[model samples]
Target: MSSASSSSVSAAAPASDWSAARIAEAAAEIVAGEQLPAIVQAGHPVLRTRAVAFDGQLDAELLDALLTIMRRTMHEAPGVGLAAPQIGLPLRLAVLEDTWAADEEIAHTRSREPLPFVAMVNPAYIPVGDGRAEFFEGCLSVRGYTAVVRRPDRVEARWSAPDGAARAAEFRGWQARIVQHETDHLGGTLYLDKAEARSLCANEEYSARWAQSTPEHAARALGF
Candidate 1:
């Protein structure tokens, strides 16, 4: 199977950096149409429920499979992040990547640096300071629109690496928002739950208003 057209959907910067052939390879596997794990929606019984930790060894195959499914789901839904719980997996894991970058650059020949596509396992976030920003946020599970949400501008987090090593990192700006959004999913919360009452916007309106907002503004408007 040929890789799905990188042009047809948003992808992480790393995926954008992949050569057409490389994307084709991955897309072939995806286009063959493996069963999509269930994506739990808002008001679903399990979506509001917390997920369990992944207790087994962190082997390469497991990591690859998780990443593959994540990429596929993100492509199919054209979403920025996905959680195992959203897929009905009940595991405390999620993937977050920059789909917007792919949309912006797919037509160009220049290769950009890979955005670190995160595979967080049993992740935890610790806010570093009192700084807060609002950004527009959309969810794969919620579908159809985005909402203004406020979130910390920066965060310190600890997560298990694919190789099972614990690592600590600091994130700010868009990266921070992405991490927070995916983390919320693992905890059985969606951005809709956190969005301020007046911030909700139809998908088209949010896109038109926020398509060019600064990272901070985007985060702020979304209530990140």
Candidate 2:
């Protein structure tokens, strides 16, 4: 699949250094702002660069503030998840939560489930069992379109929690998909890298023709 190589949005990034005090100061500036920080979009260098793994870059109090804003930004974006690079911070931090309407049929077909908010640092995942689920996915960075991406249906997710404690758990269904997408950000990967080019469609087209819970119809028509 050919990846789009264009961008129409950008952000003014804070300085990138390995200093804890500098990171804390920049993060504090963000927390102090009234407006939501700009979400860096496609073609931004930070989004394509590997993120620095969290390693006590910020003290506990500032770390909490950073996580809080990340969480709030995700909710405000009305997206299920967001990554640090998407906000112009090249740190291996991400926030994820899944919420949806109570449509029984859609919920069952999409394997949709609600997930509580999580802040993961230096996260990674491995497939639990091999089987694939293909669905239309989109990203805030790659705004205005979505494509069919096949992903593992289950995974063993692991990461460090805000309290600097190690955490691991099994996730399946849509929750697993969320984990894969967010974790990919840490490695400088986007869903489009794994998407079927034939299934790429603008958001309007998706609403008009391919909004099904499953991408079976899209896959067949697109011949992926």
The candidate scoring highest on TM-score is 2
Instruction: Name the 10 consecutive residues with the lowest summed lDDT in model 2.
Output: 1-10
**Candidate 1 residue-wise lDDT, 49-106, digit = tens:** 5655555533467556766786678767766667766765555667766635444442
Q: Which ranges in model 1 have alpha carbons more than 4 Å from their true place? A: 1-33, 57-60, 102-114, 208-224
Worst 10 residues of 1 by lDDT: 1-10
Q: Model 2, 1-224: lDDT tens per residue?
A: 01110011113333344456655666788888998888888898777766777888788888898888988888777788888878878778889887646467767976888888889988888887787888888888888899988888888888999898999999898888888888887667788888899999998888888877678887888787
lDDT against the true structure, each candidate: 0.60, 0.78
> Cα lDDT of model 1 overall?
0.60
Q: List the residue pairs that clash in candidate 2.
A: none
